[model samples]
Target: MKDTSTGASSGEAVREGPDTFKRTALLALGALGIVYGDIGTSPLYALRECFTGPHGIAPTPQNVLGVLSLIFWTLLIIVSVKYLIFVMRADNRGEGGILALMALAMQRQRGQSTPVARPVLITLGIFGAALLYGDGLITPAITVLSAVEGLSVATPVFEPFIVPITLAILTVLFVVQRHGTARIGSLFGPVMCVWFFTLAALGVKELVHNPAVLSALSPVHGVMLLVHNGWHGFLVLGGVFLVVTGCEALYADMGHFGWKPIRWAWFSVVLPSLMLNYLGQGALLLRDASAARNPFYLLAPSWMLYPLVALSAVAGVIASQALISGAFSLTRQAMQLGYSPRMEVVHTSAEEMGQIYLPGINWALMVGVFTLVVTFRSSSALASAYGIAVSTTMVITSIMAYVVARERWGVSRALAIPVAGLFLTVELSLFSANAMKLADGGWFPLLLAVVIFTLMTTWKRGRAILAAKLRASSIPLKELLGSFGDHPPLRVSGTAIFMTGNAEGTPPALLHNLKHNKVLHEQVVLLTILSEDVPHVPGAERVVVEPLEQGFVRVVATYGFMENPSIPDVLKRCREKGLQFQLMGTSFFLGRETLIPTKRPGMAVWREALFSWMSRNARSATAYFRIPPNRVVELGSQVEL
Candidate 1:
């Protein structure tokens, strides 16, 4: 078995050097803008949705307290305990996400004598990751729609212009993605600080008048709500789950800022503000049940309403930005890990490798967001579509986390099972509640997830079949090199590098080049790039050189799934290993395979056709690998899959 451990093992300490108070505070503030955006902004609609949404219940004192109790405990147990404490600990070399956790769990399983069901875990992880794309779509739509909805509460005249204004705002948000957030990113922290403070202030204003609402903090109210309301109260969880919708963002973005900053931002600022705001909303409902229609916006005084709507809109944009950026990052990871087709990826910031913009992904999300906003029209309607994707993803994360705890942390099953069981029970209930909304717009995200999942699995399986076919037909590198002594081909002066998937086999490009051109280069380098399970591969261990007969060498470059592979960078590193290259003097030969759909034992004909279409549309290897287009030669071949 391969050594699956990235340099940092589970037992190793996370280095937080240069951890001055200023730096830590800055990081925590940054965490506030990015990590807490989704959850923090939940105050806009979560409480109001419970009483006024599709499955809303009457905001009687008992029901209000019950819903508030459920919201409070849900945040405490799920966000603070489940994600910040447990799931964040299962990081893959300081990276977190469904894919990262999946990789981590799979990596540990590779090292075990008695491995668990690998396929099941991978499928679940992929589906979970797919669900995030669905979440990404709905988050921006719902958050922005809810924020803009506040304008109507301020005055009914703004109701007619809400959708158009939202469309305009979303257009600007997606448009600015290409320029990157480096400049505006600094402002995110301070702006969010204002947002959170306003949230606390608004909540306190109401709480002073009705301190009786604080009793909902007791878990008994939440339990009693379910008991008294019975099935209807259980259905209230669908709306309640919205409070924790952004919880995954906390874990997914763990690598951007360390877990400590995320935790600090949560406990020190975000949690208190959110809880107070929620309790205040409950208090307002106690005083006036009619306020349940728009409790969040109603909390503001008459003069503050417009300003609060503006602030809510800005906060919504920030939250939307975070989710959109996450989608870009996730797409890149999927491409690198072989689960997605390659698309053009542009790095937006020189200092930040994580800042990337994918035109295809950006535009696709823009389209999805537009469809969602137009179809649902109102935030209350979109609320019916929201929680299903996130709840299902949470359940998947819990399962993957359980596997990581048992296999990687070496935690005994005795302790892990009950802990995992507790999370799963809560998550499943949330999922079950959301399931009731399947007919009322929840199908949208689930449908999108299914489509994406199909494409991903098709691409992965198709690539595997294609590689197997190529390896079967290709000659071994040793055999090809050994035959050179007996019958030497005409030697050219320049160095030729052929890229191949199989390190041990002669590249199809090389074979095609020799057969057609009838000549071999003075120096032949067969290069293969491998993506490891880790988040990053250290520079020193990136390139491996193996010399073969007659000036033939086999070079393998390894990259982590999180890193992009650059041919120029690999060659620069090669210089340290006694292999030098002149950019102009080197020719990169890549195979341009035309995939043919067939019924011969692999995938179904329709899937083969889909794979072929995807392969043809994928970004060229030359562009993706950052090889100079001027120094490239493509050799064409046909492969049946």
Candidate 2:
């Protein structure tokens, strides 16, 4: 089956998007709106961070030239070469990113015996996903703080309000997310396009002064920065790498825009301009030291700084939009995979697969990000909170990529080991640099990630344990039929389907059917829907049937967290199997088992009350599955957990 797992599978859908080159070009440009927002807006504060950050280096010509050169080449090697050119190519039928890539590797790794060399790929994927929680908190805080702090550039009078203004901007950003990005999405590409051109213009202007600054393309300069300054220079890598912070977004967003557009945008516009801007900053600094405060802002006319800041704040909002939407998508995908508990998902668009909403995830991120903004409250503070998560995630992606290459594609020893080893070098370096920031507000994001990772792990474990316990106690229908073989089957009026937790079980309604009505329908249907991590199973895998003597056994499916299986459609699949199709009076069987308080206790009273509360308001299977209201039956049983 084709996997919607990662960047490695993006080929199918992206190629399928448009056959004509012109149409494809338009689609690619259109995609730049949301896809490239993160990297595109780095001009807002990229150069400023390098100069003003904690460091001993003077903002003199040599230092300025050196720092800007480092920024330029880093963007080239890290973003352009690593992700845009190389990683984005690994799409799974137009799906892209670390998760999709790992999903592809996992399908190929199924049932393989563990070996010393081949650790599990899912573990790597989980590690990467865990790191993203850190990325999420810092992304919003840094993006907003950087923009709001620019007000100080307009006038120092705005300095006192920076914190409040930053908080207000973030609150507004999260609050309006319910509206979805469809309306503003059109504006994304144009704004980013303009932003890129502005960066290039700045770079080109500086290049005219001292074109030799471009010679920093030599790798030795990067080595020099690390060697001479030693630990302090390593600290700058923490800030320097911020220029490439949006690289992960390129992969995460591939599912929505397709790899074709993202690849085109990066190569044609995003990469070149970023390099130019960095070089220009370096060249300008080479000419004059005082201009080092912000070669980016200095690239523009003094009159334009406020307008530039305003434009940047708007663009930063769009950048935050990409991550916000991405978190929703990842949560939905995780839920679909049975890694998370049931969450309420709302589809935001008829035509766009990328537009999705999960109220639980949205609110949680809103709270986390807002808390971060209030606590850190400055672009510099939030910067300390950002880089480590993004860096480690890149490392994890590399590990997962190695798994895919070795196992799925069957790449030989020489190729796989070297590629994985190469990534380990760069990733370890970036990770180590970012690691030094852990105590300086970085713990906030780490703490957030730990909390989220714990919740996710607990949900997966709890559900698995509960399902296993039910399955162990379940009575198979064949054995059940044999037990009651002496008696003839009873007759009932309507068809009934049990929404069961386990694939095989004596649903409480079966006992109720025997006790109350004493008869079965002309056609009895025992149905159970299975959840899988994969999204959108093809029709062939949609249903499985096993017929017993009295009725037909039907197993229909949907997804773990995102999708609700349509009862009518499943019934249609059942009929297509030549059994029968009946919807009007078909009764859905549900077990409304109540948790009874007992002296032989397991949980605290508060916990018991919480569980009971959850049960009371928890969405019913009928509504969750879109089953009709009237034709439903619930069989209550007394139970304790």
Instruction: Give the Cα lDDT of each candidate.
Output: 0.89, 0.69
| Candidate 1 lDDT, 1-641, residue by residue in tens | 00111111222233445645555577778878887888888999999889988888999999999999999999999999999999999889878899999999999887572544888888998899899999999999999999999989988899899999999999999999889887787778789999999999999999999999999999999999999989999999999999999998888777777777778889999999999999999999999999998999999999998899899999999899899988988888888889999899898777777777899999999999999999999999999999999999999999999989988899999999999999999999999999999999999999999999999999999999999999998998778878887999999898999999998898999999989999999999999999998889998899999887788888999999888899888898888799866778999999999999999998999999999999999999989999999999999999988
Which predicted model would earn the best lDDT? 1
* Tens digit of per-residue lDDT, candidate 2, span 364-409: 8888887887777777767777777888888877777767677767
lDDT at position 637, candidate 1: 94
State every prediction's TM-score relative to the real structure. Answer: 0.97, 0.89
lDDT of 1 at 324: 91
**Superposed model 1: Cα runs more than 4 Å off:** 1-19, 111-116
